[model samples]
Target: MARVLHNCPAPAKLNLFLHVTGRRADGYHLLQTAFQLIDRSDSLDFDTRDDGVILRTTAVAGVEHDSDLIVRAARLLQQATGSNNGANIAVRKNLPMGGGLGGGSSDAATTLLALNYLWQTGLSRSQLMALGLQLGADVPFFLFGHNAFAEGVGEQLMRIDTPDHWFVVIEPGVSIPTAAIFASSELTRNSKPVKMLDFSGAYIRNGRNDLQAVATKLFPAVAEAIDWLGQHGTARMTGSGACVFCAFETRDEAEAVLASVPKKWRAWIARALDEHPLSHLQ
Candidate 1:
């Protein structure tokens, strides 16, 4: 009999703040950032198939069938567990790609966790997270199952408590490639590192993203969005992004700001989530 899990939510993450401390010799940038889980999500449905053929049955525009993270994650787990089991995967994409919301990584993490259960693979959470790392740097953080402070190319995670808040996310209508942002000579890579003990909820608004300068220069819409949102609160870029966000004390406050956004842009009012929606599932 086939097993099914329906309406699983792969929640997006906001980089409350991102700092580049240095670049490794291998060209990977070392980062320090806090990942905030949000209610906004990409919903997924998975059905196990006894035929042992992993496939993404739904269409995601601009994404190739084999190139989809959901497909890649399923295949990786299939190989890891030596399971012939397969799945019919459906991704209902709500989050924008390259918006720095970690949509794809969250989807990939959900795939591994869901497939492990459906396939009856006895891999531990740690094991699943390790496999997720091979897929993307941000994947393991989702598997970590909580708001986290991340470092070491975004894989090293320490779960943290964040005050519940609402966010006004302004999508700049441009896709800023992370590779180009990181490769930019103008990007700062010498931010002094700070420890978790140094983090405080009171200072949330004081945090900054070091990549913002370069990103703004490359994608002017991002800069414009940031400037507009700043009128409501402290606006900053999330990850290497075209989407800029500002935190608000309440949902209504966030929504009010969202309402004032220019008609040309897209915006959302999302509440911060303390834990991943799938935390209990795993």
Candidate 2:
């Protein structure tokens, strides 16, 4: 019997707080953020084929196969592993692209992990993370498979257990260009680095995103989203985003806020996951 293909989830991420502490000589910004996983996720199914590596994408809206990160990830894995057998990859994309949710990175990480298992490559998690770093900085965190504090262009990660909460994420009908935000001179390039312990109580009281002000200026929708969500509770933008999210004490509270969100904007309520969905693979 043909090996039954396995299906896996690629969860979204929220940057609870992001601070651009400095810039590297090479122009990469040094950042500090707490990455929290969310329940909302995209799905990927993998099956081995007899022919040369063929990547077939399903009906994913707003993404072309050639430009899709999943395809790029699969190709990267193929090249890195030097595998003779090609696999068919089907992605069911639910996460919005360029929303600063780390959807693409999660998908890439899933592809790397799934393929490694299916191919019997026996590559260790560290090995997979090394390969994932080539795809994207967030990719490594997903390979590590847990909530983490990230720094250094978001590649360096230290795992930590974060509080469990429900988040109401609101995405205004606008796409924030990450490159545009990063290139802006107005973006914050210096913030005092704080220790993890310093953040425990400080986060709830004074958590902040250095990019929020600049991003809001560039995209009014982000500002609007933040303003809208703040009506319910403390709200903040995650990463370089057009999406703003607010945490609630319970799922019902989050859902209650979701009901009142403007019809023009898209929104969802997701439980904050302490462990990444891919943790079992680790």
Candidate 3:
């Protein structure tokens, strides 16, 4: 009998704060950000098949199969591993794309991790992370599977424990192109680094996303979302984003705001998870 695979979740992430410290000669921006996992997630299921490598899509509505990162990651892994075994992959998209949730990247990382195990590739975590970085800067961090402090084009990661809390994430139904925000001249390219302890004390007051101002100026929806959420509590962009989030002491408090969220926007109440969704995997 063929083994039946169960579902594996790929959770979304929120950047507590993001600061651009400098730019490298290679054109990559040096960044400082804190990544915190959320309860909200996308899920994937896999079943091995004798066929070479086939990608099956179960993407969210309006997401094209050809452009889905999960499929691309699967194909990339198959080619890179030179493995004869292939699996049928199905994705259940729950998180929004271009929302600064790192949904796509998380899905890709989950794919690589799951396939590595199921296919008996026996790749080490570091090896998988190295492969993941080629897919996206955020991919490596997701593979690390814990709250992290990231730097160096968002590739360098240091695991950290974040205060536990619930979050109200609001998406203003707009997609901000990350590349456009990164390329904008208005982005703050120089920022002083702060130690993790400094952030833990008063993250909201001291931490900031240098790209937020630039993004808000270009996308009023982002500004609107931030402004709306700020009224309830501290609100900030997760990354180069269209989604803005705020922390709440309780799920009920977060839900209260989620209920009042403007109909024109999208909102979710999520528990902040200290560990990454894939942390349990060997």
Candidate 4:
């Protein structure tokens, strides 16, 4: 029988608040943020092959199959485990690219996790997470599988419980390149380092995104989205964002606001998730 895992989900994330706290000599900015999984996701399906040939069976516009993170992830896992097996991976991409929602990173994490199980490679979760980091900083957090307080280039993580809040997310109709934002001289890389307790306390729902200022300034559509959404609640840009979101206490509260958002921008509502959907994969 051909082994197959179908409809596996790769969920999106929201950075409740992101702070650039420092810089490394290597040009990576140190960070502090909360990672919240949401119901929104990109889905993947895998079918094993005997020929040891890995391939993506679907097309993602503007992304070459060989260069896609999904393909890179599968090949990386095969190398690490010395597994003489490969699979045809298909991705149903729902999340927007470069939206600061961790779409690509989450997709890569799912690939590592699903292939690990399908290939019967018994790697511990921590080992998988370490491997995930080589792909991207945010990749490990998806594999961490919990709402987390993240620091140090967004890789260091510790689980934290988050309230089940409803969120209204708006797409600002522009794809903001992450590298351009970080390279801006206007970006402040000196936010004071904060402890987990600080995130737990006064800023639990009140924290700010240090990158928001630079992002908004660079992308007016983002600023317009944030300004309009702010009327509903504590609206903020999630990452180095082109999407802005605000949290509400109830789904109704979120929906009501969603209804009133200008039709020009695509918007939707999602509930907060404390754990990744694929967390249980060994």
- Compute each candidate's TM-score over C-alphas: 0.98, 0.94, 0.93, 0.98
- Which of candidates 1 and 2 reaches a greater lDDT? 1
* lDDT pick, better of 2 and 4: 4
Cα lDDT, all candidates: 0.90, 0.83, 0.84, 0.91
Candidate 2 structure quality by residue, lDDT tens digits, 1-282: 233355689999999888889999988889888888989999898887656565764867777887777877777777887876667888877888879899989999998888777777677988888888888878998888888888788888888777779999988877776788889998878798878666563564377888889889888888988998998888999888978899887888888899999899989999988776766663
Candidate rank order under lDDT: 4, 1, 3, 2
Candidate 1 lDDT score at position 23:
93
lDDT of 3 by residue, 117-159 (tens): 7777777888888888888889998998888888888888888
Q: What is the lDDT of residue 179 in candidate 4?
A: 93
Q: Is candidate 1 or candidate 3 better by TM-score?
A: 1
Give the residue spans of candidate 1 off by over 4 A.
Answer: none
Candidate 2 has an lDDT of 0.83
Per-residue CA lDDT of model 1 for 3-100, tens digit only, reads 99999999999998898999999999999999999999999999999888978888998999999989999999999989999999999999999999
- Compared with the true structure, what per-residue lDDT tens digits does model 4 show for residues 153-223? 88899898888899999999999889989999999988888877656835647678888898999999999
Off by over 4 Å in 2: 1-6, 197-201
Q: Which candidate, 1 or 3, has the higher lDDT? A: 1
Ranking by TM-score: 4, 1, 2, 3
Q: Which residue pairs collide, candidate 4? A: none
